[model samples]
Target: MSEVPPRAATAAALLIDALRRAGVRYLFANFGSDHPAIIEALAADRERGLQAPAVVLCPHEYVALSAAHGYAAVTGEPQAVLVHTDVGTANLGGAVHNAARARVPVFVFAGLTPFTLEGELPGGRNTHINHLQDTADQHALVRQYVKWSYDIRTGRNVPQLVGRALQLATSAPAGPVYLTGAREVLAEEVPVPEVAADRWGPVARVPAPEAVVDELIADLQAARAPLVVTSYLGRTQSSVDKLVAVAERLGVPVVEYNAEVLSFPHDHALHLGDDPHPFVAAADVVLALDTDVPWIAASAQPPAGAKVYVVNEDPLQESIPLWYLPADHHVRADSGLVLDQILDRLPAGEDPRAARRAAEAAAAGRRIRAEHERAAAADMAAGRLTPATVARVIAGLVDEETIVLNEAISVAPEVWKHLPRTLPGTLYGNRGTSLGWSGGGALGIKLAAPDSTVVAIVGDGTFYFSVPSATYWIAQRYGLPVLTVVLDNGGWNATKRNLRRQYDGGAADRTDRYWVNLQQSADFPGIAAAAGQARGTTVTRFEDLEDALRAGLDDVAAGVPAVVSVRLDPISHQAEDPV
Candidate 1:
């Protein structure tokens, strides 16, 4: 091991040391002119055989941020991200939104222009682009999305500032945090402060109050019809077990709305359907656990006299500007901790109607499962390859060791319906409605859990947004073999549906509308083949779907990334009214 450097070391070295002490393993970065000092520092540290975070070079800013998002989501720990000053930061807007919405802790760092115009130190005002890129308020670009933003003006304060940023980012309602450093400041010498390895201790999860737990228990025992709704309940594997145990013990049904992660076992008896509208409408008491939008109020509302209780780290959803969910009691605490407390405070005996309620919920779950199977069979019988059929086929091929990352917006309902996720950390999706998150996120997930098979299911429109060439190249270079399945529906199906919903029987509702159509689909398989390190295949017939998926999975198992594209029929399910 390399000895500790002198106190008068570059600020970048101190920053790197602080990050390493904070348990950061990887640094996802996109290099640029402004990053020379930090780059040199990292190179020097490696040359001396000092322990430092391994750097992963990303082809684009979005890929870098999204990769960090994926790693954090899987490990429940923040990773570092470095980008160029202005243009690079702008490219991360969409990715930052996804991280914030998912509540993933990410430490974002960017290089700023030199503070001194004249040559005062190394890496100070070397190029004309530096002057052109410098801005008075670079932090403003990402302030709205991050939990905290700061400018490291002095080299001596780098360690303290970085420590604080990590603390805030991993605290309650964890999210991304941003920090900017000027070239001159980073190159300057600074005194190394005596900081502990775990300077910022693990984030303290706030538990629900005794009174709140008692009240919730009383309501659960009294209510004849109760429901539990959650979106991100399975942040950790232990949390998933706790949530399931609490719901089963109380005989309450759980409905996962726009689920981004597998919170409860899909095959469990107390597990209600994914659609929360019907359950919310009929529930006498609703327990919302980390759900942002439980139900669409315009389409379905809870009973007028229903007692709605919400338990989340951030009950208000501070990232969203205008959030108005009806709740009778708002307990600001960690969802997993609250569930544990509720379970601990349970009364001696079960509810009088617990057995009956459990049986009814189980029956409802069976009906929902049957309906999904029938719909898939009907679609197959009609000789049309539907998303549900594809999902079921894929689900049948993989086991608990496979991880599925989904960015299939229009086909999500089918994906959720057919693919039953029982293992924790087996499913992930875009929580922020971003198009390209899954592809890059899969790479990060694979890096975090290299032993598991990582598969990404994306739509044609979302596939292009994923920058497939860059993602696949990174996979091949890093020896990360991920299986990517493209659901090619010819055009932007979601956009067309939205347009028709708003402009039905109007001029814009015509099929020939220019903005609604994504003409000339590319051969995704061909693009993947061009990467030289990956194999690609295309399936046009439903009979070939299973075989193609199996072949792709085989390639992944052999340490080779593969892409399988399925040309789907351009049928709009949204055109029909809801049943």
Candidate 2:
């Protein structure tokens, strides 16, 4: 970066430098045979003391991609990921889907098989495995999920192309982008182009139009019962603040359906519980702000003639093939900016009607809280280690500053009920139905916010899906101490529950043939213990739950990754004749 003229360098080194120039700080990488050129470039850069993004070696593709997703969720800054060829891309699997659904920007690059044959070029194919790995279309694996996919043909424009990829990824309605390159091109040395900083920037927020402002204002002011619903608006702290002001000013109760972050303080008078069904049914006006599915129309819908306003960065959800939500008005702009506009246009004086609505909502909130508390108490009295009790115990162990990642699939509602998230950036959940994102997500969150306590609550099935060995290994190696609570219910409870719900009188249900059951004994604690320098423990009885959870927290506080497996009742099965 001195005044001297730039020199030629390997495409790999230049690409790394490109990421650094683009403000990428870390590269979560899982290497393979195709990455030799990249490895050599990294080594050469190190020898010359040139700056580049820090490479965090990941053993599995799922963890690598999920870690990048988690980091972006907290910081709102896309990170970089490097994986192997098609095989590694296949392994990315559901984690990439999770990233796409969450709208987290990430730069994902993979190595492609060498195009040259034996002895033909410096970085030509050298192994039989290379022949097996080559695909006619490598990007086809994830092309449907990513915003953009490209194969880098030449090294001349590597930096500029990388900048463009990142710019597209970070723009509004952000998501991951894919890039792949062969070894020969990556090893080709070329003069680094003078990078232009201004050309590859993200598009700024598009403000809401003023023409429909008066109509929206009139509807909001006239409605007797208005409601607001959101999912990921809380991803940005300022957005959460703006939403709170606007909702409180209008006395509109807010509900979070499948929320990925804590958008509103749970204790607020206008903060309704997660389910939007009951409120949506009675409301005359509804504002669906930054939510994909405001309500399942079959289960719940607004009154026949309700005034519905759909507002988001992408109100139509163009990425999704079929998004048929009802909307009277569609505002395609930044949700936070729209909230700011609404707050500014409202009258300064408080309305008597708005105050009365707030008071009624407070009563409704109290009822909901009491109902949940009673349910938890009843479960405790049943002498079982229920999800409610597990959630309550974990809730007691964490404070407002702790970063909690919830992937307790069937029992997620219980977790949400017991653990009230009061602050922004304190809680996250996967918007996608991926089973194991939270394991690596906890690591990424810790990496981004090192001072915060990170706790990940995962189901027994999700724990297995998360590739615990790889996740915990990264945690131990990187000095990221995270407390993972495994809610062991013995099997895939969500899948089994759905089966029973749909086939109550069917032969499979009558025979108690729940094929999804994982009846085998699993020592989840031992799995954690296998990771070097990590602590593992188990709790079965309700009485011992608190102590075990506290001990795990203590271990994490002392700088060791810990796993506490809390065993709930196993899935019930009818006795079968001896095989």
Candidate 3:
């Protein structure tokens, strides 16, 4: 970019340059026809020594996006997605929702069939392009999930289009953006723009209103005690440093706000995992930061009549949900900027919030201790092996480096405590409520980090959602080994709990009802075998369940895929709720 005159490049190559200039480092995608031009362009870049974002081929559109989601969580930078033109966009939309829910920034590009242009060319190797693929507009498929989307109409428009999308997607409350490349557009000759890095270039304004911040800050200052809850401050390691600085400077107790990845390391003195109800009640002021602020017990909501301040990049637009409840006073601004401003302005002479932070930290320690005690007591008293017992038994068997992917949300406490995640990289779970995702995700994690063991724990309610086909994909594509724990609860345990909580316990008998229960349960182990998992076992008690899991882990360590099904109480599994 040394002020050279414009040079001719294919539209696809120009788009790649724009992305490369935009600081995108990874692209997760599956092969597709309409995208051969882009792939060819990527190939040319490799030939010429223009570095391409490492492309990770995914088996399914969902897996590609999920991997990107995890990558964004790890890197804290925008990750890109390239999919086929028609069916690809349609398949990738669900993955976009996962990114949006996690607030992960993803730039998605889908290739379009250029049938009209093909008609202009002599009979081509890829003939009857219209008959083979779709030329009709497909960007409309994901407009709702993405923040911005448009088809590049001309080759000359590549730089502006890519730059604008990247800038917007990486700004405050980052999420997904969709872009399209017509086959003809990919073929057109255009000059690539001068390379310029754009991330953090535009000032990140708290797009949320300002008055709400003032009101909330005043309310917080007036409170005798306050708690701040968020899933995390930063998505990457660099973000963690800034987050730690803010938390330490403020002397505020930071609670993990319904997070998958550690927002704050669990062992930190001021860090408490989600149980904000008591803390909120005890506090005179409450600050809910980037959190999904809601009680699992829908019956009991966030405490009423407390001085509440809700701050976010986009403050609860129109009574939006943080976790469970709507925000009170909303301030739209960057968390890092706000933390800096508040720290710069506040008193440093005395630590008034120390006692409160200490109290919550103490409570967290007690909660952890109690959970351990409960696990021990259950192990001692369990007559027949159950999910809880099996989990405890397995904990005694696995190594320290083993990684557990938990999809058992209903029995999360069971799985979370079964094998403690004392060290980093020991456990992973979905932050938001997306089931069936873990079945495929665990395989991806294992493949990415193959030196370690990967175990996926999923509830029966979620198992069928991620069919055995997903597992087979893991075996066929990555040759990855994973121990999948199918928690065979009778029904959608979480849904039944909802029904019980609703209608004043009117549907008690629905537990046995056709629609509410797993009356037609599938042969889970058989399904696993069909999906290419050898030595899949169905466990009915702790006698064989833990043993089976240990054997599976060892087999996996020796390069074999395995599955173990454990019977779990659909109701009253671990604790109906963690709180």
Candidate 4:
């Protein structure tokens, strides 16, 4: 047999090289038969010592995408997620919806069923399963959820397609993008394109119009009651700094409602509590900065005469088919850039009423803090293993060097109130309405900040949804040890709360069976232990909580994943219970 000259670079090889060139550091992958070409190309690259994005094998697609989401949230650098055909895409589930809603940039690609059947192509279908896996449109699985979707038709343009896909993925209002290609296309040999790296770069952040900035500042300066609301602006550290500066300069109270990140210091004098209803009702000038839903209209709304301004990268939320937020001004620009513009354009002196407003805000903040502190103390004294109690204990464990992933659902509001995240990047939450994000997100956070202590505060329901075995296995295999503290109330507390909220004396509430309850038979600590080298502990008593948490933290410090499950008091059935 003659030794044939090796064919030119395969599409998969080119794709890997393209990812490296685009500054991708990791490729979270869940493989299948559809990905043989990519698998072989990666192996060949390894043999040749060619530099490419490091591949991290994920047992599930949700974990792969959520890890990518976590990495991007911390580093502001999008990572790649590769999966199998339609089946893998389907398995991605809520992670896809979450990534899109959270505006996290994750490059997700999948292999497709082979186009050829009878050996006409180098990577034709050799198995019977390929026929069953064929889909008319694989991109349809995630098309609506993703920012953009495309299919790579040939190896000749794989690099360009990848470049375009990444450009969109990392651009303003960044979100996940989907790409797919058949096995034969991935295996086809083709020449690399001569393209400049600059061509593939993300679109530069745009500043708000000077006139709009001038008008907004004037409104703040003239208004007696001005309020600033943000959700995820703190995704960037500079944004948080600028927001703080702007709020201080204007003596405007800032409310971080349902915040996905720590937008402003909770201890700041002008920082109001998470509930924006009262503030919204009183705000004469409301600046909704980078927040999607500043105030729920169903619950409360600003005065009809008040000037409401919405500033965001995608102020219009074009992707959302039905979004209606009445705003006097809708400025479509980067929040950080607009904030810089506001800072630069503000008048030299503070307003006459600034001191008065500051005093009022500080008083309001003190009252709110006192209430939270009192609630926590009462829970401690009552020997009730409540969310507030768990949160207070967890708060003691966090520091500037720690990154907390909040996915505790019903318990998250308590976590937010008790855990005062003064630093910008120290705290993060899954804003995508996904149940199983924190485990994978913690892994990604660990990957991004290897020295920082990563902790995931998850609900018991979310723990089951997170594919704990896969996440722990990946953590153990990759040497990424993170502490996971599960706030176990033994059921879907959020679902029960919703049921009660809509129907005060609902049948489910009356029966004390919401149908959202999970089986209490499973031992979470044992599950964690069986998954990997994760040390697991169950804390049923309030006094033992601190020790258990500290032990978990110690395990994490010693380079081992830890799971500390704290069983808490279940949701109250009484109508007087806070919804």
lDDT of each: 0.84, 0.87, 0.65, 0.87
TM-score of each: 0.96, 0.97, 0.80, 0.96
Candidate 3 residue-wise lDDT, 346-442, digit = tens:
5656555555655655677567657766866766576555556766766788876677777776677666555555445556667646667676566
Which window of ten consecutive residues has the lowest lDDT sum in model 2? 1-10
- lDDT for model 2, please: 0.87
Angstrom error at residue 335, model 3? 3.3
Cα lDDT tens digits for candidate 1, 477-578: 888898989888877888877777788767756544535344435878778767637887888898888899999999999999999998887543333225
Best by TM-score: 2
The weakest ten consecutive residues by lDDT in model 3 span 569-578
Kindly provide the TM-score of model 3 when superposed on the true structure, using C-alpha atoms: 0.80
Error of 3 at 132 (Å): 8.9
RMSD for each model, in Å, please? 3.4, 1.7, 5.7, 3.7
Clashing residue pairs in candidate 2 are none
For candidate 2, lDDT tens digit of each residue in 22-134?
88889999998878878887777777776467889898989999999999999988899999999999999999999999999999999999999967877898899989999
**Model 2 C-alpha RMSD to native:** 1.7
